[model samples]
Target: MASSCTKLCLQCRSLLCSKTVASTWKYATRAHHCAAGTRIPVHFLNGFSVLNEDQKTTQTRLRWKQQMLYYSNLSAIHQTTEVKENKDSEELSKANVVVYQNPLLPVDAVPVTESQMSLDLDAAAELSALEEISDEEAVGISVPFALPPASTSLRDYVDQSETLSKLVQLGVNLWKLEQRPNVGSMLLRLNFNTDVAPRLLFLKEVGVENSRFGYIITHNPFILTESLENLQARVDYLKSKKFSSETVASMVSRAPYLLNFSVKRLDNRLGFYQQQLQLSATNTRDVVARLPRLLCGSLEPVKENLKVCEIELGFKQNEIQHIVLAVPKVLTANKRKLTQIFDFIHNTMKVPHHLIVKFPQVLNAKFLRIRERHLFLEYLGRAQYDPTLPSYISPERLVSLPDETFCVQLALATLDDFYLFQKTL
Candidate 1:
């Protein structure tokens, strides 16, 4: 028995040596094509050796198979860990951040820093810090005008000057000046003196109502600094054009900057109305009174408007003149607006041209307002627009009434019904 066991042991040792050498040779053959510095695992080589050993017993083969499986599981776990680490590094490199500060600030207000970009930062904490900083810095700075540093209250800044105070008292809306930095600067730059009072009084002397004087000066603050001589000259020129003193005051109250225009500028606009539109003196005066802003702005726009009316809409030149005289605001209408109103009156409502010529105010009404009232009257089955019918309501009566008045006089609906109709619209 001993002799037999010794022989078996020798055989096993020789088999183990031969198998190890064969497996090592196989590993070297597979690794021949691998890049330099690539590592070959020792346990995988050992696994091959265990599988190829000359073990005759079933128990010995089972132990080798268990050892191989253990090494394969460990290898799989290591590969998974390595892949996870690589993905984590990739995510860290691609992170981005946005800072929500005021757009009005200069670039130098918030400098970019490396620490702000770190992955470990708490985003909520950083965003709150940025918003707080923005509020503290963004209060009084304007893009067009550099304001005095807001060390004092805006009201206090206005109170330091007598001119600003008088302007506020004279009816310049304090709220408007406070909101606009440039307007505040304009007020600060004014050369207010006893002359200021006289200029304001000049508006009153010209027939500008006391209640309206403040509103006019507030709207056109430049009027406060206008020369009394220049203002008088504009007033005298208007009188030369046949505007009564009361008419001049009403014009100034309606548009105070009308007095700010030079005499030549006024003449050019007046000439356009007289010669170009062929409006007579009374028509010219009426047009100016009705639409003073038309004279205040360029006549080129008015000319363009009239050209569109005559050429595009196919109206006779006399018809254009009549429209201008009756509703001078028609000259102020933009091309798109004029097209829409003309289309509605002629094509949609089917109103005749003679009636439109008689009451041109229908052309000046807003398209939506016209549609709303017409549809409401049509809804009540009371839109008796046939000229032959006695119950017919004229386009003038249809659109000219105030909402409450229209509800009572025409629709016979309550004010609440009109309001609800407006909401649906």
Candidate 2:
């Protein structure tokens, strides 16, 4: 039996391999390959096995021509094996995706594939015995070794398929993430190839702290040429860089929210928006995603009389199925004018007794207060611009509107001791 199997291995090898492959052997049961990948068992069709029982059991195997049906079955089995190998390769690639660094993952190493599978030497000999069946004797030959067309270069093909699949997954996740307001455009932004591998290794070394972020990294790996951690470390080395979490949060709040930018700039927002833009219901109360219907209700419809247009105002998740309020391009531009108009309130225009937010919102006859003056601008800015309020005192008709991004840039740009936006506000 061993001798017969050995003869079959030698014979079938030529039919199975490239002419370049130096004598491909049926892998010995005891022989091992360090990176053999995986092998799977395939059950032949029951009917084929039953019908071929006599032929399979026969010691004097029919020449290839005499056993066309058996050869056809063998060809089918080979094709199935090829498909199985491709699938195994795909799965192996997925599992070995380098996990991001954190306590969850600690190190990086080579990818491995293993399976407790053994191929029958008798079956291999049976395949080998088919090699002697000449094409004329067999009626036809099915060449398993007839390689696929050489259109896809070996290196490029592997990389294009593997890396592209992983990258596509990453892009989809990022698209989903962009729907959230704060971090819509956040992604690794890989600039180079050399940078990618190390960054991937770093993630595998550190393990991503945020699993969502980590998942993105594992699939679409990127390495920053310069470590952000090192930059953060150097910041502390230079000065007392650390601040309280509360302080940071407060700072962010005070850091000039660019609510009203240009309509053109607003149009540019599609690029930034991710799919998952989760905002806390508590902190950002009465969250206004876009503008109200008082802006453009006439264009859409007359649902619940959108004239003056503010439906679903007092909502609690129920009783509200989205109100397609008019997007207020006019109010946005007008409210922008109000920033300067609010500032102009102290010197230029007179604040009416009823229009409290026009100037000194929180008591005292003067335009400013001692304790509340620094933060007073924020309160008045919102009060003067709050779309919900029934304000006959419109700052919309002002001469000039402050550019919100410029206002933000100007506000944050300088290291001035005093608030620069105070003048603009």
Candidate 3:
């Protein structure tokens, strides 16, 4: 049964954000089970828009028809890769991890070699050991004079630069210098690494009247590299591939360049990205689609009911031929929770056009310049979207958005950083 397409909940977000005017996401289309013991027929959040219900047999088929609200994450490692699936690929189910840190030891005292319960104590240790230091080489940003007013914080833009700014703004020295050349960019990276880097966002309206509508937003979008000097090399990596003109332009325009890779917490790595690859197929001619729970309350309900939940989704593909190029070598320091939180944060604000046009294509570019990479694995929010308002935003607010369209706003912020690309205008 095909569920009818409906408008997304933008009112709640606008009321909450009260500022900011833009957002984007990556979506892949593929097929997969919705929830255990639940065959909810809806689009998959990872990317696939059409679920291969044919695969939904009496045992493997979906039972209920639910709408999914997806926020795509283009930066995640696997989503960027095109992994070939062997029907015989091994699947690990129910992998559990237990931690045994000494109660007497402060959380920070747990050593990298010791935190086996957490996936990457080494990475955590690396993160904790990072000192609060600013790079003398600050990069510059040439905005079009009309960057949307900070009326809405970055959280208002995608996740939580809104309140996070409040924390960073407390740093009068850094906050006041943003208008200076290369200062804003340098400070943004600095703030991302500090205690202020761990974002805190509220899933409002989740009160007793709307518990199901609210969910948590995680921090993500981390930079793999620390210096802006790496931007040139990263851009060169993309330009070697010969991408489309539009791809090159967007990347160049957003340059300086920062990785700001997003992560999510997952007990199982294979399980998480598996869904990413499959659901992403919907945008193309994939065989099936799996939907997430984007909406609820029967067609008969007519009125906005609280039974529905909306989730932002993020999906990215590197192309079937280069599928092998996208898989990430295990980061000796990477953590499972970090990855999961990145996913949650990425999707929460991933824009729709991201994968349909930019992500893969940019990788195809022959001349790309990456100026910076911000590695953030922080917590953001747990909020709900009201399924009743407009789904699309007005183009006036965001030149990237469609005209007169009511937009779907993500109640989350990204753990990623704002990447700056370069080329002569």
RMSD vs true structure, all candidates? 19.5, 26.5, 42.9
Model 3 spans > 4 angstroms off: 1-229, 239-242, 252-425
Which is superior by lDDT, 1 or 2? 1
TM-score on alpha carbons, each prediction:
0.59, 0.19, 0.15
Q: Which ten residues in a row have the lowest lDDT in candidate 2?
A: 23-32
TM-score-best of 1 and 2: 1
Residues 1-425, model 2: lDDT tens digits: 99999999988876756311221121111111211211222122421211223333232232212223433433454444545554666664443232111122112211222320112233344546546676685777555443234432222232334433344443334443334443322232343344444544443333232233334433222223346465233223212323333332232122212112223432233222211112233211211233322211232332232222223222221111122112223222332332343344532343432342232222221233221232333334422333355432233222122334322332223323225645544
* Ranking of candidates on lDDT, top first: 1, 2, 3
Tens digits of lDDT, candidate 3, 1-425: 12322223455455433111111122222123333224534454424344445554564332222212222122122222323222232321111012222222223322334335454454456533346534542233233433345432233322334434543343233323343455344334445454233321111111111221111111111222233434334434434434333443333323212122111211122233344334332231111111110111122221111111011212333332122123111111123432343343235333233332223222221221110111111111222222233543221222222212212232123222221111111
Model 1 lDDT tens row, 96-147: 1223122232233234456553532455445553455465566754555344
Index of the highest-TM-score prediction? 1
lDDT, candidate 1, equals 0.69
Best by lDDT: 1
Whole-model Cα lDDT per candidate?
0.69, 0.31, 0.27
